[model samples]
Target: MHYEKEDWNFELVVAGAGVGGISAALAAARLFRRVLLIEAGPEVGGTGVFSSVSLICNFRDSRGRPITSGIHRELFPAAYTHYNEQRVPTYDELALKSTYQQLLEAEPTLTVWTGCTVESADVENGRIQRLHLQGQQAGTVAAEVFLDATADGNLSAMAGMQYEIGREGDGKLQSATATFRVSGFDLLKLENPDIQTWPAIHSLRLELLPYYQALKDEGKTANPRQSITCFPYPDGKALLFNSTSVLGVDPTRPDSVSRGMEEGTRQANELFGAICGHPAFRQARLDYIAPRLGVREGRRITGEYILTAEDCLNTRHFGDMIAACAYSLDIHSPDGGATRLESIPGDGYYHIPYRSLIPVGCSNLLLASRCISGTHEAHSSYRIMASVSAIGEAAGVAASLAVIQRKKDVREVRPAHIRYVLQLRGQFTEGEVERIPLPASPQQEPPVSVEPNFKSNHD
Candidate 1:
């Protein structure tokens, strides 16, 4: 175990370069905090880029008001324009990746370390005193605050924080998918060339369902999805397929993830062939498969407040709300087949309190992504990219606030201060957040109980 001591010192170190991590890094960097964003993969986009998740799930309240407006809106501007609930909301991953790259490059205070994984964590007194990362750039990372944005809660788990995996019943996670793209479609035969609209997309999926059904009947494919689910690219030239579900693929198990990839790629090709006979897809060609598997569920780090299904079902409001999520409780059955989706009852939205981001027993750690403290059902609701990005942005601001206040513990930081920054950046929040004397110190509030199929992440 020969490793030299080399520290990449910063005020904040965000692990994982997914949408959440990227958002957090940007938020912190913009706040003039010396920040570093480390990602295990070669690229910065994480699942949204490599896994090619096509759709940008709705991030609006019942009145069709955009609740998640900060970093998410910055990432996908089309989502914020001319709000229409009837339009099929989808996004181009390439465009998002380009935006991330440009934004990261623009942040002079931010340093991004791609192809790096956290190998060891030095924790003492419930704080990450030191972090050793291995990859092309192997070194130690030291920060006053660290954001765990691995989506799977890799950083929190590495720091020995308590967490839960998968559903409570059998502890099985949602299935993984290997999305793909197809271009050169015969658009003339479809209802319209502009397939981005809700009507066209809905009609197209129904029209192509019989072919997919025939394949299932003939045992030519293994995808459990009922119809041909896909979304149009922004250019309207290609389609991103979010189909092909592979059960029993846990991100923690390297072997499981490896096997899932093979099964998923096979399923993608099988589905492609099954639908090639259709008129729209006759000349369409498979562009490429996603580089990473889209694993919907991950470790839910135990935080001060564990958001439960009840919170989402009741559409509960919070006094310390830093961000809001309007998506439904969409749970993809671990066993496969049809997904179970339950809408967020009344207002069609709920506030995500600051306590949910603070890990239990961890003094300097915070959840910056899909791995935030929540129940399995609640996790399914907020795991979507839109909500995840908001969580990341909030965590980044909180981490910077902690550093600025010189607070020894993250829990000592105030929710109102975080909300103030988020509000300044145009993020959504509601209820009474005690406008604390910030630029000074703020108080902490204790509390809270708080995907996809071939099931979309509409929550």
Candidate 2:
């Protein structure tokens, strides 16, 4: 294939247009920094959109206080406005994709390039100097600072950064999923008509369990999941099945991911067929399987501090804290058995220090996704959308500060300044916040109108 060559320069270049990348790009652009966001896919919205993971995982502490805000709240406002513990919080993928597009387009200093991948990186000493592009658009790109929001640490790996993958003992990863959406089910036929409530959804799952168990007994399906796991959509008319566990898939291996997708799709179909046997789902229609496989765990780049499970469960705090996570340590079994979930002990959240975002020995690169330095167990917790978005936002602010302060290395960018900016942006911050005056006041995020067609039923 012939490639067109072009040259570009920007103050910040974010690789991967997922939640993390989008948050990072938007944060920097809002600060009037020229930013470029590159995605390997044909469009933005990464796993949340393409993989169809419906549930907006918990971002609240044990006391029901939200620890994740800012960009994340903007992306899923209904999650906050309609908060209810009894109801499962979820977002429509199409609605979210539209929101991402609108927010990105509104930023004058931000440029988005889809169907593009960073083929290589030029490193001098411990800093990345330039990046070579490939795919739909080819070019040589240079940036003052780079954010590896690729989710799997693709950019960091290309920059020759050291990283670890999967669990330490045997290098096993979390099971992958091929989620699907279904509609037209008879709500009244269920034991409880309100599928939006946790109790109702749990009863619905139990009601459909027999058919799935029968399928397994008959040797008709290969899915190893023990139960039916699903969440109701915001409109309450559809259900998103997050079941179907496919093990042994690694993001680094293209063939493995492709095979995983195929197997996962097969399992989805099998489970859908089984679920259709239920009285409530007799006329249910399988809308479609997600276009992309949901690969949960990936490369964790080595940063200055590697967050451990001990720190997470103990609710550890750091002097350079830049973000926080309230989600549980959720690890889907690599052997395709039961999943392990452990909640945070104290305040139900732990601080994510700024050092975890800075890769060890790297002066200009920062981790903006689940790939940030952490052990396998700890990665399972903050890998959710909420914490990753907060991490991305912090990285973006730090990167912009590095450029504005004329700092030669990212280490010089103070966490206090990042926290101060984050607080100004309506994000939750802790510890001391040092005010840093900017050339211009940061632009306030405009209010985004909720989608007219979809409405949350939560009280």
Candidate 3:
């Protein structure tokens, strides 16, 4: 091994360039912290760009309030404007990647490392002392704070933090999705006009059922719009796919994941080909395939407090709310269909406690992304790209606070002050606690044990 003893330095090193990592890097950079955003792929936006998963999720709070404020408020609304009035632009991976690059390039304090993979890290006293990354120029980087923004919690796993994968009884997390883009056709000419909503295609799928069944019976079959969702884009094109199907994948194993990506792409293409041949998409042609597989579920690190489904249903707001999530529990199945948990009556927003992002026993590392503390069901809601971005912003601020205070444990920060700062920056904050009136119905009583999908071994 070649050893050139050159000390690498950074104030904050953000691992992964998805929404979470981008948010963290931007936040730290704004605070004048020398920041490095490390991405394994050639691009950023994580699954948002890679999987071609469109839509910024929901930005409002439970009470119909705009919860995703701050940078989120800026980015999301601008995205809406880029599209026609009737359509809200699903975040295009390439567009967002350019946006990330442009934003960071303008900031002198931040540097983005694309096509870089973190091989390992040197840890001492519950902190990352040195990080070894391989890319065009293999080198080491040292940072005061490390943000675990990898969708699979790679940093948390490297640091030996507690976490869970898949489900408990079944050990299956959720279905992995493969998104595909199709073009050269007038999607606006479809029998059903509206393209954004899922239900828009429901009737159309039924109308095309006879032809689909005929193909299925002849062994020349293709899944219909019933399994696929199409969102409109500019021109005569659309993103015509959805994340469905659960494959038990071991993320730590490179070979296993590699196989999954190949197979997932094949399935997505098969679906695309079927649609292209069908009457609905006969004129359509394959536009582009996602560079990364859409992984809807993965390893979740056990943090100080696991956000629960009960918390989501109750619309509970914590004193130290890092951000808020308004998306319902959107759980897709291995066979295609999905089940959604209805939002709480009245205002349907929920707050994310800062404690959920702080891993237990780990002093210097914080988690954002799908791996943050939450039950399986709760993670389904919190795992959305929009919410992860918000969480990453909060984690970044907290990490900066740690550096300033010279404190190790994240729990040492004051929740009240954090909220004040976030609010001042235009982030959503819980103003006060309120109790909801329960129905008098006896069956409506709460369950004896209510836990999130991913439960932490810690208290």
Best by TM-score: 2
> Candidate 3 — number of clashing residue pairs?
13
Model 1 C-alpha lDDT per residue in residues 347-377, reported as the tens digit of each score:
7898898899999988999999999999999
lDDT for model 3 comes to 0.69
Ranked by lDDT, the better of candidates 2 and 3 is 2
lDDT of each: 0.85, 0.92, 0.69
CA RMSD of each candidate after superposition:
7.1, 7.1, 10.4
Model 1 bad stretches (over 4 Å):
1-5, 191-194, 433-459
- Residue ranges of candidate 2 with Cα displaced over 4 Å: 1-5, 441-459
Task: Please give, for residues 242-308, the per-residue lDDT of candidate 3 as tens digits.
Answer: 6234365466667766776777776666656555555666777787667666777777889988998
**TM-score for each prediction?**
0.92, 0.95, 0.85
With a 3 Å backbone cut-off (N, CA, C), the pairs that clash in candidate 2 are none
Q: What TM-score does structure 3 among the candidates reach?
A: 0.85
| Residue 248 C-alpha lDDT in model 2 | 98
Quality of model 1 by C-alpha lDDT: 0.85
- The list of candidate 3 runs beyond 4 A from truth reads 1-5, 79-89, 187-189, 194-226, 234-236, 243-246, 334-341, 431-459
